[model samples]
Target chain A: MKLREIKEILNAEVIVGEDKLDIEVKTAFGADLMSDVLAFAKAGSMLLTGLTNTQVVRIANVLDIAAIILVRGKKPPAEAIALAKDVHIPILTTKYILFETAGRLFAKGIVGCLEKVEAGSERI
Target chain B: MKLREVKDILEASVVVGEEKLDMEVSTAFGADLMSDVLAFAKAGSILLTGLTNAQIIKTAADRSIAAIIIVRGKEPSTEAIEMARELQIPILSTKYILFETAGILYSKGIVGCLKKVDGDFYK
Candidate 1:
């Protein structure tokens, strides 16, 4: 689905890369843990998360993510916003909580990047 | 829904609270961030998260959450398991990632504790 449709569906506000709403994203990964994103997230998929740290933008850049969707009405810190702008990554903020955010997108045909999670989780 | 049904649907294993699998929970909150779980999560709701630590048990206890659904096949620290056993709160470990866990639960009529998010989000 195009980022434009996701925006409308979630009532999300584009905090960055407003011009890139036309970008199409077929998969999504949701997590508040940055480590999980680094480990399991695939390239070009949208990241749905509650984390607003600058590292989020940096990681998205490293992974070639399509966009960052912030749930539970979260807004980025100024430094994170600056970093995202510098990297040209799109960021959208939505009022839905994490569960609803994932459910809404999944209901619209957006799927998780990985169908099956890896066998085990490491200590943080 | 009953905790037994949830465990079956998510293919979750009972890490704690085996005797309480019949506990009924009607709502859920998904997050990996503990702060959000503390702030927005309601009492008696199931918490779906990718975090597994002693702090998770403490937070769930403070919030009176009905259960902890640990996603991504994450295992809690030994300290956390002990705490949950002491607190008598159920913990279910699922292999599904956070997104699929929430989507599946939401699809099954387990709704988010907070229906409409509050106007502004804090940093």
Candidate 2:
């Protein structure tokens, strides 16, 4: 789905990168543990978390995530926003809880990050 | 520096885990691009970036970063907040631009992520 559609469905507010709302996002990941996110998240996936810290933004930069959704009515600080702006990432904030938000988005057909495993003969 | 102290300096708003504000952060990495943050950030370090997306949270989870700071006066979506809340990760935001923010924090002695090299040990 397009980043704009996810924003509209969740009734979220855009804090940065408003110009890139039309960006497409195919995969979604939900986690609060920065460690786990780094280990499992695919490159160019959507991140859903309540953790609002500068580390999170840095993590996104490493993984090449398409957008970030702050769930459960939480808002990041101005510093976080400024960093996100510099990176050209679109930040969205919504009021729905974590599970519900994930469920709603999943219901809309957003898939998890795809893992590419090696096979004996051919790539899967 | 302690997360709480960082919060105070940046005048940031904590999104969750108020009790963990006293957590110590020794290093900080600044970037707007998620790709670079993931490439160079050290484990248990603070992240400063402008990109806001679920992927950012996922990257932090993987790297085991101490905290996240969103610069330039931006906020994340509810989905993102809920995920961070579940992970017990503390989120903070500030109004300082990328360069200025890094400068202030650096002036306070917060260093960048550590650099580790991988090579033959006994060559």
Candidate 3:
């Protein structure tokens, strides 16, 4: 889906990347813990996080994430926004909590990056 | 540097993927915060974290990490180990604190995942 559609779907405000809302998003990863996002998020996937810090933008850049959606009405600090801008990463914000945001995205066919594990699959 | 060299450098014990220790690591990321790891770690780089959970392994697998080294003497849960083994991502353990471990590797020329910001370069 286009990031513009994501903004509409989540009622999100674009804090940055307003000019880049046409970016396509095939997958999304939502996590409060950046470690989980780093280890699990796919490159180019949109990151939905609640963490409001400069590290968020730094990691997103390292992971090559398309954009960041800060949930639960959390406003990122100026440093975070500056970093995002420096890296050309889009940042958005939403009033919905993490679970609600994830649920909405999942309901719309957006999914997390976890590799599917079929039941009774081979164990390592 | 080879993963084996990292093992030797840190005196880490291989909990899994001992055979894959020959893998080369050009960069490394050390963080307790998984967010930092995900945001900054380069693919195929070694992950040094103190967090011992299945999510760690899951995230590493998602990020295509070469391996995971649990720092500060933390033991990963059975589930975490099984996940890593299933994903074929090696798991190692070290007694060094995060800073000391990072310092040891940095001294050996292992660098972090952060992008270099040149000073006075039009920031």
Top-down TM-score ranking: 1, 3, 2
lDDT (0 to 1) per candidate: 0.89, 0.69, 0.74
lDDT of 3 by residue, B48-98 (tens): 776899998998899998989886566899999999889999999986544
* Model 1 regions lying over 4 Å from their true place: A120-124, B120-123
DockQ of all predictions against the true structure, Cα-based: 0.73, 0.02, 0.02
Query: Which of 2 and 3 is the better model by TM-score?
Result: 3
Candidate that scores best on DockQ: 1
Q: Per-residue lDDT tens digits of candidate 2, residues A1-124?
A: 8999999878888987789899998777655668656755667888877678877888888889889887655678988888998887778887654434554565576765632211221111
Clashing pairs in 3: A34-B34, A34-B35, A35-B34, A35-B35, A38-B38, A39-B59, A40-B59, A59-B39
TM-score of 3: 0.49
The segments of candidate 2 whose C-alpha lies over 4 angstroms from its true place after superposition are A115-124, B1-123
Please identify which of the two predictions, 2 or 3, would achieve the higher lDDT against the true structure: 3
Docking class of 1: medium
lDDT score, candidate 1, position A79: 98
Taking the tens digit of each residue's C-alpha lDDT, what string does model 2 give over B1-123? Answer: 899998988777787668899899877765545654565566898887655666787788688988888765557667767877877677787755443455456557676563221222114
Worst 10 residues of 2 chain A by lDDT: A115-124
lDDT of candidate 2? 0.69
